[model samples]
Target: MAQGPPPPSTPVELLTNKGIIEEPFVNKFWGPALFGTFTFIGVCVSNWFTRRPVFAGIQKHIILSGTAAVIGKFVDDYRAGYLAERDAVLRHYIELHPADFPPFERKKFADVLEPWVPIR
Candidate 1:
């Protein structure tokens, strides 16, 4: 009996079927904020051990943490906005030139496209 075509094989089949993993929201903001807070606390403790005023530097720690949080938020927002813009552009292009994309794949991109908003 003739067997059908051999099943596909990979040189390293162990790596196949791996799925994408997303990062947690905490890593984007709280992680950086905590790191900054701890670093500033260490500095304050060091100053206290050296007979320097520790309270004077408390505001600095708060500012550093806030800054880190703000920066993290900005980075996250920018990334999301960038991806939205990219999808919008791609959808527009696909709509304008339907023949360029395969029919089977067009349905996957059928979601309503987001309007492009220029960054101020």
Candidate 2:
């Protein structure tokens, strides 16, 4: 009998199926996962340095930028459904820690952040 094409046999093999590669990588949480992890680590290091009197040059901009990056990842993942579970957890935490978030104030960030974050 003639041999048919070999069947996909690995976890990665499923990616070869149609509509896999073409789909958004965020749906798999790869992009947000990497960005959030790196941003969090950098934020912690920057905050540590901020406490020292020697590194006066390391402005609070690091924390601001790092937070923006993390939020950006959350928005990206939420829109991608990668954060569906994550969002629930965050929402729960935020609910418990009401002081962490600011009142909903619209800002120019919506111009960029909105595009990345879908209305859901």
Candidate 3:
């Protein structure tokens, strides 16, 4: 009996195959987890600064990436004409049911408030 090729004996492979972990965890929640943790820390620090005002000017920086992602998606969708098409559908519905969507008469609050002025 000639020796066959050695079986795959990597420690990680053995542990995984032996049910230590069926599959490794691919962490997709790191961003949200880190954000929440940092936010909690910021709140704690703010509490610590009770004697003086806590001026964290970089608050927006925390959410800037997510905000930009949303804005980018919106712009891309608009450029693709999806937004225009959706708006057109909404307009068509409003036109179809004019009673439900009353047309706006362009008049200022001043016109309503000043009865002394001549009604033009």
The most accurate candidate by TM-score is: 1
Candidate 3 backbone collisions, by pair: none
Q: Which 10 consecutive positions of candidate 1 have the poorest summed lDDT?
A: 8-17
Give the per-residue lDDT digits (tens) of candidate 3, residues 1-120: 977444434322221223333323533344445555566566547656775344444454446545554555555555547755765677566666767755445567987875677668
What is the alpha-carbon RMSD of candidate 1 to the true structure? 16.8
Of the candidates shown, which would achieve the greatest lDDT relative to the real structure?
1
For all predicted structures, in order, the TM-scores are 0.43, 0.27, 0.27
List runs of model 3 lying over 4 Å from the truth.
1-79, 111-120
Rank candidates by lDDT, best first: 1, 2, 3
Candidate 1 lDDT over 7-81, as tens digits, reads 324322222223434557776666556656776777688778989888667777678767766766677678777
Estimate, for each residue in 7-65, the C-alpha lDDT of model 2 and write its tens digit.
55432332234443355655555655566567656666766777844334444545655
Cα displacement (Å) at residue 6, model 1: 28
* lDDT, residue 7, candidate 2: 54
In the order shown, what is each candidate's alpha-carbon RMSD? 16.8, 19.8, 27.4
Off by over 4 Å in 2: 1-27, 52-120
Selected candidate, larger TM-score, 1 vs 3: 1
